[model samples]
Target: MSGLAASERSVRPSSGLSRFAAMFGKELLELVRSLKLIWVPIVFIALGIMQPVTSYYMPVILEKAGNLPDGSVIEIPLPTGAQVMAETLAQFGSLGALVIVLVFMGTVSSERNSGAVSMILVKPVSPASYLVSKWGAMLLLSSLSLLAGYGAAWYYTGFLIEAVAFKAVLSSFLLYELWLLVLLTLTLLLSTALRSAAGAAFAALGAGAVLSLLSNLFPKYAGWLPGALPGFARQAVMGSLEWSSRFGACLVATVMLLAALVLLANILLRRAAAID
Candidate 1:
């Protein structure tokens, strides 16, 4: 009895929470090692600064692009800070989103292709813990990148143009972050399901594009989709977003879809592991 108790004590398992934290730390360490934690945020900051600077100097640039016909006045009005900020968000939606999806698209697929995922699953970690660790780490990186970029954009916009309201910018940031979470989670889900990183990235980006196209084509009918999040975010920056049933539904739908993607990714990874 004494021997059995000692053996059991010696081999005692780690709590789920401990395993989760360990796994999350491992993911973060991987990000650091890969320099993703550094360069991605830098890219975002550069993107943020570009919008205000480019908008501020557009008239000057055009003036120097060769003399226009005399009296052919290009009376380009300077954009307000909120408009410039909105353009920055649009830049994020396109270029920044592509960068983010591409960076993370390989996370699971590369691990699985190299048998690292199988090795990971062989340990005493639950699939949920493993998947969520990746998910949480990616989310953390996204938050840091977005905040750095948004802050840079806000500062530059205020200096170069009019100052955007604190409340409006904050609201836009929260909404846009939620939208980004939904986007990244979808890419992560595809990465878990597909073995080809490029294929996963392509599919996720295509799906996002389709959703955005549909929302633009049918704004009244499709405003509740996740694609509408950016428009709502733009409205937030412009102080035009309102709390209505439709907006509430869109918010709830995005959250539900996020939860569903995380759950589905966990299930897919488990099924794949079981097959292995």
Candidate 2:
């Protein structure tokens, strides 16, 4: 009997993993059908290219404007490659984050409202599998989009501006990607917790804004928060960041918070399925 029980325990995890893969595949197919896989990366790449291009051409752009006097000289100092790359990430922090939130805002709630989740729950599928599948898909999408965008920005910055160290760019990318992950996870959590997709998006974005505001207003206190990630990313690019012990603490805290949110989302989704 002990041998049988042990065998059953081993089988359970394999089955669960299969279910998660199936669900993740379905989400990926849906993303493709919705053209999210195409347009999102395109948008990100556009935003990335815009940053370095605009930075490189600022003087020309200013001179082209009709308001400039004939003898006026625009001697604005050009930003370094690292600075340009940091500015590119700033684009992602604002508009790119919004795009991500809006795209996945309906990931779970829409299915719940449409009875799709009910259909799935009626089967033997685990709620944890369902939530994890959604999270995994979003993570893939976020990582791919950000990588494409940041790579483009890095290339442009090197070509137009000075060359930034690859190590610096990579470090900054990882840090900023963490910030994106937190925002994406927050949106997913909100989607499970709220019925309205718009409400979920608004709440997530609002929370992000509040975090950013607090971090900016009180850097000494809020430096350990996830909101300070962008600052850390910038510092990485500029090679000015001291590898503080708190940096690891903040990373761990952010990850723990994300895990808690995912767990809560799973529980809420299970309850929602029962109610339906």
Candidate 3:
């Protein structure tokens, strides 16, 4: 009896780890097999290249255009290396976030719709565990996409500007990943709330747009909201020493969002089981 108990204890940890791994592995396989994963890297790489190239050449292009007539006159300032990096990050990083959201549009909703959620439940997996595994898978994919963007940015920016700070560049890139998680959490909540994949995606996109518009209009004055979080993260990674408030606010909001999603997911799973 003593030997059996000892063996059981030793096996428990390994069993738990294996379960998490199994869940993570299943999601990973699905992610790789999906064509949407292909677009994440491609879009980010394109943005990385375009940002530096555009920054380096925009001034020259404007110079060639020369002075315009009084009615059409507009001054185009030469973009500094930092400014270029910031602009590039904003455009490409946001694009990457959107791509991640779209790719994950069906993460949970599809499973529920296709009756795969029911199948998963029969396999000794709890709904919470399944949702967590789905989140883990999305996080992994987002990390890879961000890495691609970071590598491309480093190569292009290093070539374009000799004095670029590697640490700063990395921080900016990491911030982008956090932003990805924030959006992913928001979408996860929507996926749980909506029965249709299209409905979830549209709801998430609409919420994202509204948050963005509000943040752009209010800046520091805006309350602790999802839209404010990404901006704070971006500013911090960009070495904005004064952006701590924004970063903190974003982090806090992200945590709250995840907590809310956990509650919602549980409710959905209960409802699903009831229906079954």
| Candidate closest to the true structure, highest lDDT | 1
lDDT of each: 0.91, 0.89, 0.73
Highest TM-score against the true fold, candidate: 1
Q: Between the candidate structures 1 and 3, which one is better when assessed by lDDT?
A: 1
After superposition, the stretches of candidate 1 with alpha carbons farther than 4 Å from their true spots are 1-10, 66-72
What's the true lDDT of residue 227 in model 2? 82
- Candidates in order, TM-scores: namely 0.95, 0.93, 0.81
Per-structure clash totals for the candidates? 0, 0, 0
| Alpha-carbon shift of residue 57 in model 3 (angstroms) | 2.1
TM-score of 1: 0.95
- After the best TM-score superposition of candidate 1, give how far the Cα of residue 193 lies from its true spot, in angstroms: 0.9
Give the higher-TM-score candidate: 1 or 3: 1
- RMSD of candidate 1 to the truth, in angstroms, is 2.0
Query: What is the Cα-based lDDT of residue 136 in candidate 2?
Result: 85
lDDT string, candidate 3, 1-276, tens digits: 999999998766445556768988988888778754777788888887888787777766666676755466446665556666777767754676667788888888888888888887876667777888888887888888778876786677768864457777777677667667767877887887788877787788777778767877887676456676556545654567364666577668767877787778777876785575
Instruction: Please give the TM-score that candidate 3 achieves against the real structure.
Output: 0.81
